[model samples]
Target: MTPPAALTLEFVSKHNVEGDLWIIVDSSVYDISKFATIHPGGLSVLLNGDIAGQDATKAFYGLHRSEILRRPQYARLKIGELVGRDEQQQNVPPDAIGSTSSIPYAEPTWLAPGYRSPYYKDSHRQFQLAVRQFVEDVIFPDAQRHEEDGKPPSQHVFDEMGRLNIIAMRLGPGKHLQGRALMRGIVKPEEFDHFHELIIAQELGRIHARGYSDGLGGGTCIGLPPILNFGKPVLRDKIVPDVLAGKKFISLAVTEAFAGSDVAGLKCHAKRVKDGWVVTGTYARLPESPKDRSVYVPLFSVFAARTDAGGLVVLVIPRSDGVQTKLIKTSYSTAAGTAYVTFDEVHVPYENTLGSDNGGLQVILSNFNHERWGLTCGAVSAQRTILEECLKWATQREVFGKPLASQAVVRSKLAQMIARVETSQNWLESITFQMVHMNYKEQASKLAGQIAFLKMFTSRNAQDTARDAVQLFGGRGITRSGMGKFIEHYHRTLLIDAVGGGAEDVLGDLGVRQALRMMPKNVRL
Candidate 1:
């Protein structure tokens, strides 16, 4: 309740002995006298003459991340301010929470100051700011905590997302959002477009926790769109309102044990029965399927299965007597709720069919362009974050008594990282513009291959960027914490982009196949 005392440098200088020590970081003074004995680096590291009673801002930053100071115990060590606002930390409380980065190439050029964009209007920019603030205040902290503990996102996050109607917005522009007050009316429903949704994905990706990012309504973003576009009115009314409200969960159950991305190769079968169908199949690695049985009871999912005569169909199946789920531990954190799901003779209502029984391929393909495009946006944003981190590390970190950026090799890696992310971002934005301008059918016919190629390019480049970032950071890059924590995590999880929605090789082949279909009949070659 009381203000911290204001102290001057001279008075703090005398208390430099073992029993008493003082240091200034970003102009705020910390009395690490008692803490010195218990400091993680040990008393000797804190007792150095240059740090014990001096302005150690640069030295501290060189060795530790700023977040270390934000921890309760370390923050409690701050006994007073250093008596000058101009010299104080730029991130002082109440003002420092969610400001955009000053680092060049940290954010998309459109988000950078003194930069202009043709795609984002005032509303999109405003919406992006609002979402970034929420993600910083809420999602990011939880992301770090859960990513380590391997737990799903907190319920408060789900409730907060629902309060903002973020779940529906992530599904992108649709009739489902007609009456909703999105972002507290920051943008009207009709005014909402794919770019707005892109902003949400990119902003959320800044959390730097890939597994946690997917857990935060990953299912709703990729799965619910099918229901919105194809489910019958009665089915839509029954399912849409509740799921959008964040009261329920749904995941796209397409990948199986045998069929990863080859949609036509899925062997899950549905036998015709009275009033509904009997589904028996396994849906593997469903992103964030509700695994908590007591709270959510039955997992609600929309999956693709083969009907009689070997025709693939898409249907909604609720958790029931024949349903089962087993968590699939992965290299990434378990916060994503990645599971291997089995449905043995599960009964789904006839009205639950997403589209015509045999049109599963079409039903699935209709959403693929949007899903793949969203993946590109997320991948570009994520890769860009890594680039910013690498840039910061290279600039601040000292190697051989000079800034790491001074090294010719480090600079070259940085250049390569920058080029990959910037090119991917440009391609992603161009495709986004097409999505905004074209109709759904037109998009499927014309933009499918383009989206596939864009995803392939973005994902492969992300792999390269991750490699360069790790190489630049060296040992620290591989370490899970400290200067290269994000770089390490990114290197470990970057594969999801290349393989999740579709494998890079498959996507590249599909793009070529699409091009082949549109080739001129009278080609000389």
Candidate 2:
């Protein structure tokens, strides 16, 4: 952790040969003689006379991100710094991991310097910084590792999250946060409004691993809320604490093979029993239905089934006898815990029923509103990240001896990316403000259509942004690693936002139907 030694440029330049190659990047001296051999770009690129120890700062940054230098193995290569200067790395703030980006339009307007907003107060701002730090220190490494290995997130990460009560916070403003200190008391539990929760969602999307973002606790966010609101006291009291503490996992099981958006069409059924209910159903095991089912074995499932009366009944079915699950390799990383689940005569206690016996539709519909809003926050965050990446790359990357930004078409693409993300962020924030003032029932009635439309708009914009990003990043955008890794991941995981919570087309229809329901009977334009 000590500051590196200081070295003169004269001395650094002397070691430019193959056996003693050196480079100066952002006033830091790195001896790459040994590292060059194993460098992903190969030794030839580093050996070029112009770059060999001759302040390769420009060249180094041209093809790579600042994070690559932050890796321990690479960071340790900094034996010293330039003799008479401060250490200033490109694109890295002094407290880079937690600090806000200085890039124009890189962050939400409220986060930009000198920009102010009525929606976010001091508590919200401090909470945003703290959450971003927590995500970088606690979540980023795990996301990067598990995203590639296709493994579920590490338990230690979840343990840390639990220690910080982050798992509970992800569920948003509620009674669950009453006693727990949030972000080291930056914000009080009662004062923690929807904006605070919005910050958490936005910070999480910065992880850039959609699957891990969900895998982190996606199930709990959508699934537990239903039980907490409607389940019997006994059931809620027992399941709420454990899942919030990260001791267990839960996923919404409302979707089925036959029913993607049409919940009424699910074939899953539950027969009345002596003590509880005997539930049986076969899921198409599609991506949306049972996501995260097999991530952590023995997780609780909140699903619906048709009753003897032909009405839908919602229940919490614990994974036990006759419950089976199979993993499905998805287009994105398996860290999402994508799987097909089957409930063959699974028993559900009567106490586990949520809401009225035949009112299952309302439970799932309510859960969808929150899920859609969260997804919109994340979708906007992802688009902003792509915009930042493209901006940096366009400025530094040379095309035909001039910066790529010089190209008219590239600038046009960048402009579109900017407009789309900003519109989404602005709309998302406006909706979030409404959520803050409205009660749950009010939100259910007034904001559901607005939220549905907002999510549809944000996600659809995300697709266009992703495409523009691919066009801007070019081959590197499609490449799975290095410079375009995030772009590739975002482009690949379109299903999570666009299709998971609710398909775009279906949500669009829902928004329209809700609007039609509210139309004035006798009003004229």
Candidate 3:
């Protein structure tokens, strides 16, 4: 196809009318005569006499973001470059424009060639590329489809993940991943650290299908840790391989209708029987359940419940007779298999007890640091995506004959969103670095409060970013399709991150309390 010829300023000016509207933006001319009526800001803005025959550069910048010019629908309307401008400078190579986003802060600082980071290495970059390709090519489509269909990712997805050892890799650096090949062997096991885990969480979040991301292996991410770290050797040997191989599903079930972060307030009871234990009560927001149609056989759950001894206990219970699950739909997709699980006289073998009889509190608490950190990583990454979306929207979406990004108010909101996201990401990296060097016990002792606070902070930041993105997107933000689907989904579901990993209020107080204990005797108020 022949390229469109460039139009002179005189030629552009001649077509400036209601019937033949033409406008110049960034030295390019667009014929928006047909788009006037459909423009969200209304027709008068496009038909104004002053804008009709002249360059609408200033006006266009005020409403639309730069990305709008790249949209196929708008790009096709381009008649040509301005008559006097250098053609080479005016026309950007298609490949360069398509490869990476031009909007500032649209990607992480590390992804930009001019920026440097001490944290990421060649392995991290290679791993990132492989994971991104996998997500974009394989996981993203599945996530979107399953999210819309209100179902979980297919078994084939799990099998593929199992083949690549992604399930084991997500658990962070541990003995379980020691021998496993990860990210198609892009990074060696011995070299894997919290940074690599951070990469995985962030990349997975890019799928933008939160529920489906959880469904793919969300349950296992949290559930298998206790079993692998503290369960009896026989139990660990029996369950770990199958779960990691994607032949089984497991989840952590600690919250109930009456008690969420208040672990001590749990009402589910487990009584010791002659040969085993009988558990009875309900657990809410479980990520995996046998009742979910997509789950395979041998579904398992690790939950904390009250024992007859009046102390909290953790049990790894398998789905069997008398174990019932009822779906509890939330703002996010049901692909997560959020469930109200009831263990009615369900027999759990003594061997199934994950930690010591009444010592389950430590086991449960031990997982929180990792869990909250994971939430922080995902939330921060999601916020970045939201920021990028807003940047693209503001640049491409014109209002009053200018790009939305050109508006001062929109720029202010974008600045705030970017600041919050960057702050959270830096904090997350700092905390992750600590995890890499500190032993588990040291991490639990020294970093718990910090992780809690970080999670709380990021959740709040996500709320702010989501709000700004929705406002920038306008109607499309609320609508489920088109440019706003991600922002819409994020707005509706961001609360899960705020409340799930430990509610913001709960964690905020916990951080202060934990910090108080570490205060020095010599330090005065």
Best by TM-score: 1
Stretches of candidate 1 off by over 4 Å are 1-11, 81-95, 289-298
Worst ten in a row by lDDT for model 3: 91-100
lDDT of 3 by residue, 1-525 (tens): 232475778878887777678888768877888887788888888877768867887667555545578778888988777878765436443333113456687667887768898888999888887877776767877898988997878777778878999889899887888877897788899999999889889988877888877777778888999999889999998899988888788899888888878887899999988887889998774575233474332277898889899988899888787887777788888888888778888899999998888888888888888989987888888888888888877776888878788999999998999899888888888888888889988998899999999999999888888888889988889988766888999999889899887899999999999999999888967
Model 2 over residues 87-123: C-alpha lDDT tens digits?
4543344446788988899999999989899888999
Candidate 3 versus the native: TM-score? 0.83
Candidate 3: segments with Cα more than 4 A from true spot: 1-102, 289-298
TM-scores, all models, native as reference: 0.94, 0.93, 0.83
- List the global CA lDDT of all models: 0.84, 0.83, 0.82
Decide which is better by lDDT, 1 or 2: 1
Q: How many residue pairs clash in each candidate?
A: 0, 0, 21
Please give, for residues 324-348, the per-residue lDDT of candidate 1 as tens digits: 8777777688888878878888889
Candidate 1, residue 417: Cα displacement in angstroms equals 1.4
RMSD values for the candidates in order, in angstroms, are 2.7, 3.1, 5.0
